[model samples]
Target: MLTIPSLHAALAMAVAVAMFTAFASNRFRVEIISLMTIGAIALLLYLFPLPGTNPKDGLALAFGGFGHTALITICALMVMGRGLVVTGALEPAARALGSIWRINNSLGLLVTLLLAMFASMVVNDTPVLVLLIPIMVSLAHGGAMPASKTLIPLNAAILIGGMATTIGTSTNLLVVSIAADLGMAELPIFHFTPIVLMAAVICLPYIWLVMPRLLPDNSPEAGHEPRKFIATMRVGTESSWLEQRIDEFREKLPEGFSFLREPQTLQPGQRLAAFATADDLREAGRKLGAVTAPRWLIKRLSQDSAKAGEDLVEAEMAISADSRLVGRTLQTAGIEGVAVLGVAQAPSRGFAAPREMSAEARLAEGDILLTMGRESSLQEFAQDQALLMLDGARPLPRRRKALIAVAIMGAAVLLASLGIMPIAITSLAGAVAMFVTGCVHFDKVGRALSAKVIVLVAASIAIGRLIGDSGAATWMGASLALGMQYLIPPVVLALIMLFVTLLTNFASNATAAAVGTPIAFALAEQLGLQVEPLVLAVLFGCNLCYATPIAYQTNMLIMAEGDYKFNDYMKTGIPLVVLMIVSLSVILSITYGL
Candidate 1:
C-alpha cells in the first residue's frame, strides 16, 4: 500500500531535499545556504508546530545547534590547532617526518597513512588530522608529494579507523546510544572491531597506493611560477654567526638562497649576497643572524618602532630607475623605516641564479630589495625611496611559546581520550589556556574559526533533528521494508547499508547516525529479521562518509587545505563507499548468521 507522509514529515522532507540541493549545486556559498536553512526551519516550525510539541520547543530544536556541544568542541579544537601553528609547536615533529619522506616518498607515505589510521582508532580522528596536517604540508614542501595527493586518502583511512571503536568518533557514540535507546544491548568499545578491521584490511592497499594517484597536485607551488628577488645579508657583530663558517650554516639556511662558494670563515660586517623570494630571504636572514640593511640602520629603526608601539615588517621592494638608492650599498643607503633582508640581482628573474649577488652589490634599477619595517613606515619608505612593495608582511611565529602550547594541547587531548571529561569542555579549556598563556593572540582567533563550517554544522544538526522528530526517516524505512519483503536476509542487509551510506555521504554523519539507527531498528522489526545486523549496517554506513565534504567534519577541514572540489570527493570517494558497503554487508550478515 502506498502511504502518504504526515504534514510535518512532508515539510521535513521538502526542507532537507532543498537544503541538499543547494549544497550539491555548488552555486551558493555553504554559509549562506546554512543561514537560509536555519531561518526556514525557525520560520516554518513556528508557523506549523509539531502536534505534541510546543512552539517554543520547535524553536529550541531549530536554534539549538549553535550551543550544541559538538560544534563548540570543533571550534575549541580549531583554536587549539591555531595555537600549535602560531607557536611553531609542531615544527620539530614536522621536520622529523620530513626526514622520513626525504629518505623515500613512497615509504614515508605508507608510514604516515598507517600511523594516522592507527592513531584515529585510539584518539578522535579530528585531532589526529589537526596534528598531522602541518607535518604533511611540510613533507610536501620537502619534495615528498603534494598534500592534495595525500590528505584525502589520509582522511579516508582515519575514518576507517574511527569506525573500528565505539568511541572513536562522536557519531559512533551517537549511533550506539540511539541503538541502545531502541531496546538493543549496549555495545562494548570494540564490539564491532573485527568487522571494521576486515574492511580496513581490504581497503588499506587502495588508500595507501592508488588514492594519491587519483588526486591532483594542489600545493601552493603548483601551477604558478614563484616570484624571485635578489637580497643581500650583512652579518652583524653581535650575531651568533658573526665568526661562523658558511658551511656550518648551510643546513639551517632557508629556501631560495645560495652562496657563491662556501666561505671558510665569516667576517664581522661581511656582505653575503643571494637571490630568493622576499619570504625566503627573510627566513634565511633571520636564521643566518644577518641584517638586510646596515646593522646600525636596522637598530635605529627598531628602536623608534618599539617606542611608537609598532611592529617591524618585512617585504620585497623594487628599485626604480629614478630612485636615489639606485647606486647605494647597504652601508651607504640613507634609507629609513625599512631594513634590507635580501635582494635579487638584476637580469635574473627566477630561482636559478647564475652567480651570487653580494651584499656590497650597489642597488641597481629593477633590483628587488627585501625590506623590513613598520607598515606605515614601510609604505612611507617605499614612496620616499622610489620603490614598489611586493607583498604583505608575514607574521612572525611565537616560537618561544611552542612548549607551553604543546603542553596545553597535550593535557586537553589526554583528558578527553581518557574520558576524564568530554571533548567539548577539555578543548574549550585548552583554547582559553592558549589565550591566557599568550600562546595565541586574541586578535588572531578569527583565523581559527571558519564561519562556513560553523553555520553548516548548525544547519546539519537542525536537519537531523527535524528528520527524526518529524518521523520522516521512519516513514522512509517502512517504505524500504515493504519493498524488500521478498529479498533474502543478506541482500536486505546490503540494501540497508546502501541506504545509510547514501544518507551519510549526502547529509552529516551525525545526522545519519541520529536518523538511521531508529529506522534500522524499526525496519528490522517490521521484516522479522535480526535487528543487530541491520543496526550494524547503519553504524558502518554512517562512517562511510567518503563521498562528500559536508558528510563529515574532517572532510570539511581538509577542503581548503587540499583544494578539493565537490567532484573530487565523488571521483575518489564513490569507489570507497561501494567497497565498504559490499564488504561490511557480507561481514555483518555472516557474523549475525542472517
Candidate 2:
C-alpha cells in the first residue's frame, strides 16, 4: 500500500521543489540560487543529521560537488574547446559548413542534426557538443539562425544520439552496469541502438522544425553589425591575388569591401584597401597570403608589448572632429604603439577617397581606424590622438598553432574512443597541452568558463546526493510502485518512464539511473513480467533530461550562450519527453509482449 514519506524524505522533496521554483522564476541569478540551495541543504542536514550521518558528513555532502568528476570533465572540455577556437583549428570546417548553410539553411540544419547524432553514438555527447557549439554560434552570427534557437535543439539532438548506444552516455553505461549487478543480462554495444533510434525517428520532426520556432531569438545584435574596421592588405609574392582578376573573388569579398582602384591584374607589393570587420579582414588576408599590416611592425609590437607585460589587442577607434589627425595620410599620422591597418574616409556628399587612397589612405573626421597594440597602449593612443574607442574586443587568432591544436584534439579523442584511457584523463591532458603549447593562454581560461554554470552544476550534484542519502529516492520508487500497481502493463510501463523522466529532469540523470534501475528489476519480479522492457524504460528515461538546465551538463553549457530562461526548457523539452514516453512505452509493450 502507498505510505507517507519519512520526515527527512519530506524535507528533501520540499527543498528540491523550492530549488526548482527558484530556477524557474528567474528572479535571481543561477549562481545565487545554486549557492543558496547548497547552504540550506548543508545547514538542514547538519542540524537534523540523517540516521548515521554526522555534521561532518553533512558538510562533505554539500561541498563534494565542487570536486565532482562531472564538473571537472565539463571544465576540461570547455578549455579544450577554447584552445580549438583561439587557434582557429575549426575555422576551415566551420567555413565549409557555413557555405552549405548559405546555400540552403534548411538542408544545413538537417545535416548538422544528423551529424551530431551520428558523431555522439561513437564518441561521448559532451565532447561532440563542445566541438559543435562554437561552429553553430559562428553560423548563427553569419545569419544562419539565432543562437537562442539553435543551441538547445542541437543539444537535444546530441542527447538523442547519446541515447542510442551503450557507450553513448555515462548514464547509459551506469544503467547497464547497475542492471547487470541486479542479475539482468549485460547488453551489448548495439543492443539498444535500434530501440533508441526508433524513438528518435518519432521525435526528430519536433526537434528540427518545432523547437526553434518555440524558442525566442537570443543572438546578440552586435554580431549583425560588428564594428567595421579599415584594413589594407599588403599583397606578397606568395599572394594568390597576384596577377589574378579581382572580379573572380567578387562573391567572396566581404560586405562593404571594394578596391580603391579597379585593377585588371593584382601585383606583388600592391596595397589593397578595403572596409571590413576584423574577422572578415583577417580571413581575407589569410586567403590572399597578405599581411594586414607590416609583418616587422606587428612582430616588434608583440615583443615590445610583451616586455611591457601587456598583450596586443585589435581595436577600432573613431577620429573625432577635435582630433589633430584630420587629413593626414596613414604613413604620416605617426600614431605610436599602434599600427594603422586601413582607413575608411568619412562619407561626405558622395564619397571622398583621397587621390592615393591605397597605401596612403588618409584619416578624416569620423573615420574608423583599425589598429593593433597593447590594451593600455591602445587606450593611451586613443586619448592622445583624440580618438573614440569602440566597444567590442576581438583577439587575433593564433594561426601558427592551428595544426598543433587540431592534432592534440584528435589524439585526445582517439585515446579516449579507443579505451586507452578514460575521457576525463584524456580531456584533462588535452586542456593542459593547450596551455603548455600556447594554443590557449592561461589567463584566457576564465573566458572559457561560466561561473554561473559551475555553481549550478555543483548545486545539482549536491541535490542529487541528498535525494540518495536521505532515502528520498527509494521512498519515491516505492510510492510509484504502490500507486501504479493496478494499471495494465503498457500503462504501468509508461508511468515508469514518465516517473524516471521527472527524476532525470529535476535530479541528475545519474541519480535517476542509480535509483530507477533496481526499482525496475524489483517491480518486474513482483508483477511477474519480463525485466527487459522495464529496464529499457529506466534507460530511456535517464536520457530524456529535457525539462531542466540542471538535468544534464550540456543543457547548462548552452544556457548562457542561448540566453535561455528556465521556462524555455519547460516549453521546448516537456513535449519531447512526453512524446518519447508514449512512443517508447508502446514500442516496449510490443517488443516484450508484456
Highest lDDT, which number? Answer: 2
Candidate 1 ranges beyond 4 A from true positions: 1-3, 115-201, 213-257, 265-314, 319-325, 334-339, 348-356, 371-391, 481-497, 504-543, 548-571, 582-594
After the best TM-score superposition of candidate 1, give how far the Cα of residue 338 lies from its true spot, in angstroms: 5.2
Write one digit per residue (lDDT tens) for candidate 2, span 127-199: 6787788778867767788888888889999999988866677677667766775588877656777777888
Once fitted onto the true fold, the runs of candidate 2 whose alpha carbons sit more than 4 angstroms away are: 115-198, 209-230, 252-256, 301-312, 349-359, 485-497, 500-575, 582-594
For each candidate, the alpha-carbon lDDT, in order, equals: 0.76, 0.78
lDDT of 2 at 9: 82
lDDT for residue 212 in candidate 2, whole number 0-100: 91
Candidate 1 lDDT, tens digit per residue, 1-594?
758999999999899878767766667887888889889988889899988888888889898878776677667766877787767675565555655787798888888877777767655677678778866875666567888999999999899988887656767766776666568986766678899988788888888888898999887744444466655567666667667776777776754566654567778777766666554565666666676567687678767755664546667688998999877886688665666666666775577344445756677788877667777888888888888887766554567789998899789877866677765678789999998887877766888787876787677678767877888877887888899989988788788878778877875566566667778877887799888878888888889999988788799889998899988898889988888888888888788887
Using TM-score as the measure, which candidate wins?
2
Question: What is the alpha-carbon RMSD of candidate 2 to the true structure?
Answer: 5.1
